[model samples]
Target: MPDEHDQDEEPELELTSALVPFFVITNGRALPSDQQYERTALVTALKGTSAAARTLSPEAQAIVDLVAHGFLSVAEVAGHTHLPLGIVRILLAQLEESGLVLVRKPVPRAEPTDRELLGDVLAGLKSKFGA
Candidate 1:
């Protein structure tokens, strides 16, 4: 006799959530120094190898690489690729929408809650006392 398990079944209950973290988006261009070096090496290798470069459309790949390395801005990528600035902005937006990358913007400060006000006061005191 053989025993069978139904591996095809999946749980259907929906676990709902509304919480979003403050860092839902991060600046993708802030690579550490070591990572930048690694990325540069990889870029050089890709540029040097014809077969490897052919596997990826080098034009698009270059844009992606530079953006990932945080070494190029959308405007810079556009200028290098000879693409329009609007087109570059659109492509960056697409990357963000696809979750392939994140772009950080300054968070607007919220009005102080009681807890936040108290915390700020304590922080001020600590700074004044060099604590």
Candidate 2:
């Protein structure tokens, strides 16, 4: 038989956080006005822009806060906030429009076959190997 105390006790209630959908967070917007914020693009908060951030949603504000101190790549921001890349791009565009942040595209990669550079490398290798 169960104890009298056990029978009188109520089951404990478990609390859980509500799940918010991506559309809700992004206000049903699919893409940003421009495609400037690629995954590797660097972003930083504009100085003295905290006042403007007050009007942003929680997710947008989080992005501004993350970049306030320094620069962070779009991919880094997504990873840090656990937000999807597409969502991050949208939020960043909004922040940039509000003058809350600055975005810098990554430097373009060098051409794979710079004739002069490759020739120099070949000459160095031939001299080193006596070929």
Candidate 3:
């Protein structure tokens, strides 16, 4: 027998049926066997976003709403929506195809260093403070 607390927990979302139509509609055919989307890619809603939002599925709409606030990575969307990462990727690809969302690769950040670019910070600090 399951614990009472277990019964109170929300049911897990099922995507197989719910996402099938989205995949078909977006692809204009069956789901692809192999589609690749970068998990770290950032998504942003396009301009005139309200009209575009109206054309999306409820799931896709939710994703658009989240993206409108700010750019969000693919993994972030999956986490926020509680959808599987693969589903989010497919949905994002559809949105991207329609120009409703813009997907961008995350910019690589420069590594931090202890060395200063111009000169030693201590020399400048000593000169300014006169200690």
Candidate 4:
């Protein structure tokens, strides 16, 4: 029979990694040191850069891994990592500086659509396709 005292004892708490403060993660800086990263800026791990990720913090490594497969905007990285936008920017700046990742500026918006050009293109496509 199980002892009553044992049943009353609180379940042993599972150990987990302690939370790291944001300040420590970003080395006490609120923003990236050099270039400002827009939330829309795309980031990707450079080819042959995964090796360098080993030298970074776990958070930084996670960022590298997330971008390794394809491009992701700064906002997406923050959401996936559950890290603050500022921290993601700081880490990305460091990774970019270290040549572990590439940060591409968001593409500039195209000038307002020219309806005349669209109509011409549509006419050409229809003629070529006989549709």
RMSD to the true structure for each prediction, in A, is 17.4, 7.9, 11.0, 8.9
Higher-TM-score candidate among 1 and 3?
A: 3
How would you encode candidate 1's per-residue C-alpha lDDT over 1-131 as one tens digit per residue?
A: 12244343764445575343212222222323332222112211123333433343344455566655444544556677675554444445544444444444334469767988899999999999989
CA deviation > 4 Å runs, candidate 2 = 1-18, 33-35, 114-131
The 10-residue segment of model 4 with minimum total lDDT is 1-10
TM-scores for candidates 1 onward, in order? 0.33, 0.69, 0.56, 0.65
Task: Give the alpha carbon lDDT tens digit for every residue of 1-131 in model 2.
Answer: 54555554685444565478877888887686445788889999999987877888999989999999999999999999999899899888778878899999899888688899989999999999989
Residue 23 shift from truth in candidate 1, angstroms: 33
> What number of clashing residue pairs does each candidate have, in the order they appear?
1, 0, 0, 0
Please report, in order, the local distance difference test score of every candidate based on alpha carbons.
Answer: 0.46, 0.86, 0.75, 0.85
lDDT of 4 at 27: 75
Q: Using lDDT as the measure, which candidate wins?
A: 2
- The digit string of per-residue lDDT tens for model 3 on 1-131 reads 54555565697545666535545534453332232457787888887878857867778899989998679988899899887777788788778778888988766678786677446777888899986
Which parts of model 4 have CA positions greater than 4 angstroms off?
Answer: 1-18, 33-35, 110-131
Ten-residue stretch with the least lDDT total in model 1: 37-46
Which residue runs of candidate 1 sit more than 4 Å off their true CA positions? 1-60, 106-131
In model 4, residue pairs whose N, Cα or C atoms come closer than 3 Å (at least 3 residues apart or on different chains), thus clashing, are none
Instruction: Report the C-alpha lDDT of model 4 over 60-117, residue by residue, as the tens digit.
Output: 9999999999999999999999998888998988888899999999877898999999
lDDT of 4 at 106: 85
Tell me which of candidates 2 and 4 scores higher on lDDT: 2
